[model samples]
Target: MTDVAPPVSRPKVVRHQLERLIITGELAPGDRLAEVLLAERLGVSRGPIREAITALERDGLVVQIPNRGAFVRVVSEADARHLYEIRSALFGLACGLSASRHTGSVDIELRGLLSSMRGAAERADHEMYFDLNRAFHRTLLETSGNPFLAKQYETISRSINLFRARALTIPENVAASLEEHERIAAAVTSGDEERARSLGASHIAGGFARHLGESVVAS
Candidate 1:
């Protein structure tokens, strides 16, 4: 009798799982990631693990030393701030472009996410609010029809998960963040690109600054 081989899963599936592990702090910054251990834990072969590592490296979440192997990159507040700065600029540009080019569907989608964010905030559901926050930003960025801006936004989006976890720990962060998003939505709806961009930048930069201050106090 011939032996049947197990079906191979796509690399993207492996990549996504690993991405979640990093974002949720399961695989924390500076954590050593051994291929053997990961393969065992994930119940997969080393091939997919290696591929996922490569993908993570491309996303700046992992760094592979010449001979030492892969380690999760520490996301410092400075790093977070830098990412937000870039995100702010790109987001601003996208919103400005969107001011003149937003499609009807895109506007509808943004409104829907805003509504969902309001619901999540009202219920104090941090995780759901976090997801909606991402959707709100992504929809706005993509709605501009600027593929380059969208790509940059995706790069910055990965860092946001860390902040979400931090913000949720604070008593009033959910309401404050929801309010900020509301301002952005209003600006976009009103066709005020400058207002949207300024508000968006301040919202992101303020969060990073607050997190930095909190980390210092804790330390």
Candidate 2:
């Protein structure tokens, strides 16, 4: 008897691959995503690629026009500022909630992340640091015990990947960002809700400032 293989969700797989391409700067901002080309590259049918594109569009990672096809979304300065504002508020709330519900295990996990981030920074490994940074924030949000807040935070984070990739490239920014994370962790672990909220908001605001500075230098 021949064994039947489990069905694979091609569209979901394709979407993740596309997302990685964008995050790694392979697709890049403003790059046109041709359906046929993607289908060929990913070894999938164009139908799945089309569906993946639609999903990415809903995620704010791709822009689809009536006749122009799909392109990686180019987040403008205005969009960056707007996203940062929303993220700051959400992060503040998440931190406050986490602080009010802190546990010893949660504190230990956060400290472990901080240690990993320090190691990443010392090696000048921006990519590793970026992953660790994301994990740290996500862990705090999860501690909030509000799935809704975590979902919203994730959506906005995906939309701003371009800005983050550039912002984390600066060595100075890497060090400063780690320090901010340390302060945030300290506030949460110490059960200081107000301080955690303020530090969380300020951390995101600092990233926004750095993004603007980088944009200015680039342009």
Candidate 3:
């Protein structure tokens, strides 16, 4: 009879925690990821911390410098713009498919998210709305019934999330986004594929404007 401890998954756990900090802005862009400090804070050895950092780098959430160690990546404006362009196409397609494929429960869930999102906007709860906003988009993608599209969108979303909170910086912007989401939800739920496609693509475009600067919101 052997009492064997399960295989250690410390690095995977550390990676998820570190990834959340980076996404939620606790570890801001350009923040140094000192392996020793993280190792001590997470109550593990430096080996696991280093392994986690390497994983984050591959996820495009952190960067490793030859001499300076790892840092949370600062997503550039140009890089964000390109990512947005690709997301717009994918999201629009997903919306069309979702409209064609969504079921009753999916419709109810989207409506619920819209309601929560509206309340969050009214209360100026940007963080809450940000989470719900991501949920709303993910629901549409998942309901689209295309696993490949969902997978690609999820991968791109991790990078976009580094700066997504910036999109909700102003109360006015939140209200605008709420309106856009309403239209998107309506289009999807009503089985209007073309409308859903247009609004979905345009929403991501508007999101980029809000993220970078609010000036283009009206455009």
Candidate 4:
């Protein structure tokens, strides 16, 4: 019998884990990221952790200061707002494109996401709602058939999801968010390109505004 080899660690899995740590404030902004500490905590070798750190740096989740090694990236209200603006524009264009150009399967996926979101909201399951939200947006972007647009959308969306999750968890925010999702899904299904784009942009902007209003900035 041939001996089986252990599976190699995927660079992406490491990157995503580190990214979530940074985003969720488990590894807070400006907190030092020691390779040995992270490796021990994650039950993995330092090699994969280092590779993950490099990828996180590229993704703006970690920044290295001179003579100081890696630290989580800090986000200010202004920075958050600015990032949301870029995301809104990207998503808006993607939604409009998808509405105009998407085939049958994309529409079906959108409806499914809508149903799932409705159920999640009714159950008050924030995590599931958040996951479905990301899926919905990604589906719309993917259906656009513009590789550049889809790639950029995913990059921006991942970067902001941490803050967005916190913001959306505030009282009443989830209900409001579900309503917005319904509007977006309706517009997309009806092939209302302009309406879908407009609603999508508004949804992002409103969510950011709500977050900024409620958030207490800590230094």
Q: After superposition, how far is residue 160 of candidate 1 from its true place, in Å?
A: 6.1
Q: Highest lDDT among the candidates is held by which one?
A: 2
How many clashes in each candidate?
0, 0, 0, 0
Clashing pairs in 2: none
Error of 2 at 163 (Å): 1.7
What digit string (tens of lDDT, one per residue) describes model 4 on residues 1-219? 999988756766777788767655567666899999988888888999989988887777778888989887777777777788998898888878887886778778888888998888888776678788888888888888899988887777666654666666654887888788888878877899999899988888888877666543333
List model 2 lDDT by residue over 58-92, tens digit each. Answer: 99989998889999888888888889999999999
Q: Which ten residues in a row have the lowest lDDT in candidate 1?
A: 210-219
lDDT of 1 by residue, 10-110 (tens): 67788877876776567777788899998888888899999999988888878899988899777776677777788777877777777666666767888
Q: Which residue pairs collide, candidate 4?
A: none
- Candidate 3: which pairs clash? none
Give the winner by TM-score: 1 or 2. 2
Candidate 1 wrong stretches, greater than 4 Å: 1-9, 122-125, 159-171, 213-219
Where does candidate 4 stray beyond 4 Å?
A: 1-8, 214-219
Largest TM-score belongs to which candidate?
2
- TM-scores for all candidates: the values are 0.82, 0.88, 0.84, 0.87
